[model samples]
Target: MFFSPLDQFEIKPLLILNNSYILSLSNYTIYFILVILIIYGYTIIFKNNKLSSNRYGVAIIALYDTILNLVVSQIGRQGGYYFPLIFSIFNIIVISNLLSMIPYSFALSAQLVAVISLSLALWIGNLIIGLYIHGFKFFALFVPSGTPLALVPVLVLIESLSYSSRAISLGLRLSANILSGHLLLLILGSLILSLISTSLIGFIGGIIPVIGVVAIVILEFGISIIQGYVFSILLSGYIKDSILLH
Candidate 1:
């Protein structure tokens, strides 16, 4: 039924209460709540159990340890204070992304507004943390270290722009990757479907395209985990920067 690749991103309300858009329960809400439940279930299932207890526990715990180590290395022992935040963000992204890979599931991270809002909030939180720790000196993050007073103004101006751009770039990077990958899969699937249905030779040749689709799907799965890890690493760095101001 999709006429365009972008049509996949169109959100439809499942329940519009009181004839008000504001009160509408959209598909996005459902997927988000589902993601939350899945994450909560994961915690309950894995948090209190031994890895040998469940078949999935080994892989899940390994993943938890990987992110755990990532935080500790990037932010040091104090990373424990923020590990939960990073872990939650990383799981939310990884779960939503993996969930979207399911046939007909909504891609929550593909929504620019949702992804950008989360990143923007984190960026603002970094500013607050920096201000809390360093006061007005936090603005010195724009100045770097040891520059001539004459070049300070020009360098500060450039650095300020770059610093602020993180608010948009962090989320844009994640959302753009998710959107483009899903779009590619959908387009390829559609093309192969048409090709295979056309004639005998086309059906035979569909094997390669089908193999390519499988390969890309595997790559997308890797991207889901890699993106989550990448976001965590960058956020850990930003938090470190906020605290250290170096």
Candidate 2:
């Protein structure tokens, strides 16, 4: 049987709610709920508990410290106020990415629509903050610090385009990386299966692709974590720009 790598991305309905309106629960919804539950459970477990001498507690503390340091370094002391938001974003992305590595699990972050919606929301929120703080002066973002009077309109247009593209670019980067990595894994897996099924000789030869699959899987895991970090860093940078108007 020929397996379609793209089939993994299909959004199949799991439970129908209202057939007339085509309302139904899908894998995405279930996985989203699971993500929420996991986050909630972790918080509940670690919320008020004293940090134990165990490695688990120490690891958690290190992660918390790393995130706090990142926010403070990137967005300054004022960024401390936004630590919860930044932490939530980082955890959600990291968890979703990690969950997608599970066999037969849906990759929520790989969905362009979902990622773009999040990016647009964050981008708009940052815009609102900037405008609220700077009022009309926020529009100054479109004009470079030093430019000829004749180039004002052109520079503003260019700047406006670049600024607006952030949402699309950020989302596209995450979705593209996740989608490609998963697709490559699926292809390699299918190759291994096909080779194994062909003949005894083919089965022996299948070891090569199997090894490739294992290596790629490890690489994908690292990529997933790095992507989450990258997303958080970019958000922090955006927050910095919003606050400093630079």
Candidate 3:
């Protein structure tokens, strides 16, 4: 068995439903459980007495914060209309990432399946939203707001590549950052543990590693929120540009 802190994240089958696939749960169950906890936690945050009220408050705050940040950073004051979608996406991503920090938890953000699903959903959803808002004009997103007529062919090809690449890039951005950070924590911790025995020198070496591990944990916690925010901001920016022709 691996000795890293994250080694406990292995998946175990809960039931074998079929030959090809089995229903299994992962140590990361804690993360998903925390998500449920967060539902109640929000009630506390917003001082809402009822679960329904808390859910509503959570939705409202998430949407407003995400949209407000996107407007300030990427789209300016004119980006207010996109807040609802942006906020929902931001809340989900932020909550998902944060939930992964619990012991034996799986960071679904590290999985391509989870990340790709999220990106694809956002892409398709935004495309639909843009179409709904702009009608046939949404297709115009394929064309740049400004380009020399002669360069339209090259620009179109470039834009197409960029458009398709968004899903992969967005997914990879979160997955890579999360996986690498966790892996680094594991490696450094193991290396420290290996250098010294469990005796005095070992304990001394472990002190440094313990501190390092704590720092890494804290750093990942911060990054979990940041990754979610970045994903939300980018989504908002994309929508703003698509709608405003920026």
Candidate whose lDDT is highest: 1
lDDT of each: 0.90, 0.87, 0.70
User: Cα miss at 80, model 3 (Å)?
Assistant: 5.4
Clashes of 3: 2
Clashing pairs in 3: 28-106, 63-87
Output the worst ten-in-a-row residue range by lDDT, candidate 3. Answer: 8-17
Q: Residue 64 of model 2: what lDDT? A: 81
User: What lDDT score is found at residue 194 in candidate 3?
Assistant: 79
Candidate 3 lDDT, tens digit per residue, 19-122? Answer: 43335444445455666577547636555445346667667567556457766667666566666556655666677777667655567677776678778877
TM-score of each: 0.94, 0.92, 0.75
**Between the candidate structures 1 and 3, which one is better when assessed by lDDT?**
1
The lDDT, on a scale of 0 to 1, for candidate 1 is 0.90
Query: Candidate 2 at residue 125, lDDT?
Result: 94
Q: Largest TM-score belongs to which candidate?
A: 1
* lDDT for position 205 in model 3: 61
Score residue 236 of candidate 1 by CA lDDT. 95
lDDT order, best first, reads 1, 2, 3
Candidate 1 local lDDT, 1-246, one digit each (tens): 434556547788888999999999888898899999999987886656475577688778888899999999988988999999999999999999998887777889899999999999999999999999999999889897898999999999999998899999999999999999998998899999999999999999999999999999999999998989899999999899898886
Could you list the CA RMSD of all candidates, in the order they appear?
1.9, 2.3, 4.7
